[model samples]
Target: MSEILSAPAPQVGNAESWTRREILQQPETLRATQALLRARQAAIEAFLSPLLARNDLRIVLTGAGSSAFIGDSLAPWLSMVMGRSIEAIATTDIVSAPALHLRAGAPTLLVSFGRSGNSPESAAAVDLTEALVDSPHHLIITCNAEGDLARRAGANTHVVVLPDATHDRAFAMTSSFTAMMFAALSIFSGIATMEARAEVIAKALADTLMDADQRMAALVEHGFERVVYLGSGALKGLAREASLKLLELTAGALVTAFDTPLGFRHGPKSIVTDRTLIVVFVSNDPLTRRYDCDMIEELRAEARCGAVLAVSAQPMEGDALHIPHLEDAADADLLIPFILPAQLFGLHASLKLGLMPDTPSPSGTVNRVVQGVRIHAIGA
Candidate 1:
């Protein structure tokens, strides 16, 4: 196999490429997102105050693909914080079957995350919630201000726009995903303390990026044929996003699998091979971390996977991809930091395959924003 540089930086505004610059710029983008949210705290509070106080309120986090995963990471943490039931549903599913996911007469807050804000389902899901539920309010978090979602937002909607840079030019979502995920968490966690938490996280991420890029490059050079990602709780959603990142950038040239640490043994563990790379998201919880560490040792004993790497904030007795001070943060906060290494891996893996990280698929089968889907009239 030929050796190649993974995610070499791209000159801005040039048509030549994207992934490297966008992926590397994530920590800065997150800082900007936090500032943007902080500036709008008054408006956010005015809109959410009465609605949140309602005992019947239901929160549904909906988006498509990577966007939907934002909900997956947030739903578990936010539900615990807000003391309400929240669900992460894909807009693709909600647009297809609105009645099944939504209930009429429910006071609902539909939080939609979209990078371009123009996906057919972004708008369609909003319509479905409005039509199916008697009372529906919206909090639209998108990078694109000119796109459909931004344009269609009404009085019932409060739009939180991110920095224009997060509308990434790269085919894969990087900065956009992290920034939006952070924004959603801050919005629901009470905007007052967001600045303090974001400060700690942003600084930690900046330091991690400095250390992560080279380590990820070495992993890409290992020449693995397949990759498996394992995580528990909120981190599981991140594992799903990480798997999709590699699968997309490599154009399916590299096979991928994602599951909870315990869930892997049920049947998914069969995907492991000597040519495979295993990426584990080590949890902060003592009990959960035991399961995560157990899987790492189990796979190490089997000696099947090409290498086993642990991504943890704290180091135990041995080597791991330790992020700085992650153990002190809540499980919800770890979502942002844990995602960076996976993003770096995907960027490098694309180059390792001799594929353009910007647009790997020349056949037009997959696209930046999905195309060729004719929306069926579900009367949402």
Candidate 2:
């Protein structure tokens, strides 16, 4: 008998309905965020208004898991575009070693990303930073309106809430990740205001959904046992997310792994077996694309997996086995579009594995906002 890995296929329209419903439900979060962002923009303006705006404004971008990847994606862009000092540090790291990530008596901004406001380390990081730093301003981005972080921004801090629908009921973060990311990008840069930029972003998202629905539908039909994801540069974060979405949404029925394109050659490539599904997130930058495409070609030549899929922002020169190219996706924002595809794949896998996409683990092994974490008061 053939091996069965994924859950049953969800009702055909279920994915589309969830997508639309989640987007509609997020308006309040989005609007409130607009207000919070404007306020943050004002506060930042005020803080810098007195002193000359320095390129050295230290920023620590943090979160756990998917939330951590949000920081990874934003840090480089903030550093290059805003020309500020930024680092993507996991709250776990700060919780373990505060001295390494913090500087005393320096003006620092802590941008914390959380889907549920209650991750233990998240609250702890804030407390630890306040305990150690001279002056720290916080910008909390979260999907849960009632989350501890969102409600606890206090008088001096800024809280930006994403769409309520972004609180992703599923085990994985589908809408929340993109919503929080866009909110951060909008806050730090004026990407939201540019008509052309908005158009491109919107188009990229639309195309991603339409194409992913078709491709993932077919992929899950194939029913592979294991999946390996690979990428480099900003795409590395995308690969991490893709790996998690597959693992989480499918409840680990499909074993998943991730590594940088070159990093995999060291030993991780051994994980690629005949039953594995290899998915590559190709880059848009010229230099990065060369490395990304080379790996895809190498994998195809080896044929180590049941299937090899490449999701790229642009078309590649050779005849490669992959899904459609996400055309005109010239920016890292292109990752936002690719996320829909991965999400669709996860959703389909969950259903194929006889799980519910809306609430996969009825046992409550996971939650929309994490539970069992307590908040403590730390003195300044």
Candidate 3:
């Protein structure tokens, strides 16, 4: 087992910025999220009980950017456990074609994920759902209590506001992203209630953090022009989020891409270069692990990419970053902890590039929360 010890807070250095701080503080926020779920369990159950029992319920998980990726990460696992269909749609897509997404008069529940909860698309998606569908219920999971999505709470809408500290003062989301993902996992996955499985997630993160941090620092120091994150199933969603973190932090200085292990071999492999670092989030399931391992070996043999790494709980034949004590963890449970290293790499890479992790974008073109997004009126 490895130790992810909390060092004394520094006024300067890599941990100086709020983004890095948020990235480092994720384990604590996850623990806090556990407590938040325990506290709100009954009310959440009460609200969801009837909805879960419905034969005609339509649950759509929606958001934008990293927020949208949450639905991608959660939908597959949530759908299987509950034995129902769950759709992950980005708010950007919904706003563009509400008619395609929102079915009229369907018993719908819109789970909208946001860090600040103020993105124009967040509000527009909820409104579009109302305009085109029946009286739809809303589950707003966010860190900001005063943001538009949270304020939209009413008789038919329920909002779960996470810790304020997790709101992330940084321009790029770190803590908020994971915390909200934890919240959703806790709410939607029946397995989250099983103490043993929950322990797998918490303990794996505790042990892996420091080990991953040290390794990631070296990767950033070595430097790379492009990085690729790969995974399958629930982890594919994680890969997308991880890729976004790198792209956003470097302010386009470092190009990043993501795809499933099998999907990567199909043409997308062209993106790989001598300057590329390929990261695969290896699956725990034995069958899926075969494909993941095959990709790792194939990439290593090609010697085209600068480096190849795998994050896995399962024992591997080659050198890899192992998240200890989760050898038997289900793939869904692996999603949360699997992302920490990717997020840390983004932070370290951003800092190494001599950019502020808190404000990666020095110019005003991009923002902490998007600006100048025009939400249009929907009508006949």
C-alpha RMSD between model 1 and the true structure: 4.3
Question: Model 2, 1-380: lDDT tens per residue?
Answer: 10111223336546434533443233233344444555556664554333326444578889988899888877776677766667899988887778888887776778899988789989899888887888777888888888888887564477767655567654567668877877777766752353345445655555455556777879888878888888787778878888888877776678999888889899999887788888788777788788888888898898777877887767655433233334544446666666667777887788788776666665777765566655544332
Task: TM-score winner between 1 and 2, please give it.
Answer: 1
Off by over 4 Å in 2: 1-52, 191-195, 317-330, 372-380
By descending lDDT, how would the candidates be arranged? Answer: 1, 3, 2
lDDT of 1 by residue, 309-369 (tens): 8999777654478888666778778888888999889888887778887887868699999
Residue 197 lDDT (model 3):
62
TM-score of 1: 0.94
Q: Model 3 over residues 1-380: C-alpha lDDT tens digits?
A: 11212444436555445776777677677777777778888888888888888989999999999999999988998888788999999999999888888898788999999999999999999998877887688888999988988888577788899977778888887788888888888788742474456666777887898999998989888679999999988999999999999999888899999999999988999999899999999998888888998999999998999999999987666668998888887887888789889988988898888888777887868999999998877764
Quantify all predictions' global Cα lDDT against the true fold. 0.86, 0.70, 0.85
> Would you give me the overall lDDT of model 2?
0.70
Using all chains and alpha carbons, the TM-scores for the candidates as numbered come to 0.94, 0.83, 0.94
TM-score of 3: 0.94
Segments in model 3 whose C-alpha atoms lie over 4 Å from true places: 1-15, 191-196
TM-score rank, highest first? Answer: 1, 3, 2
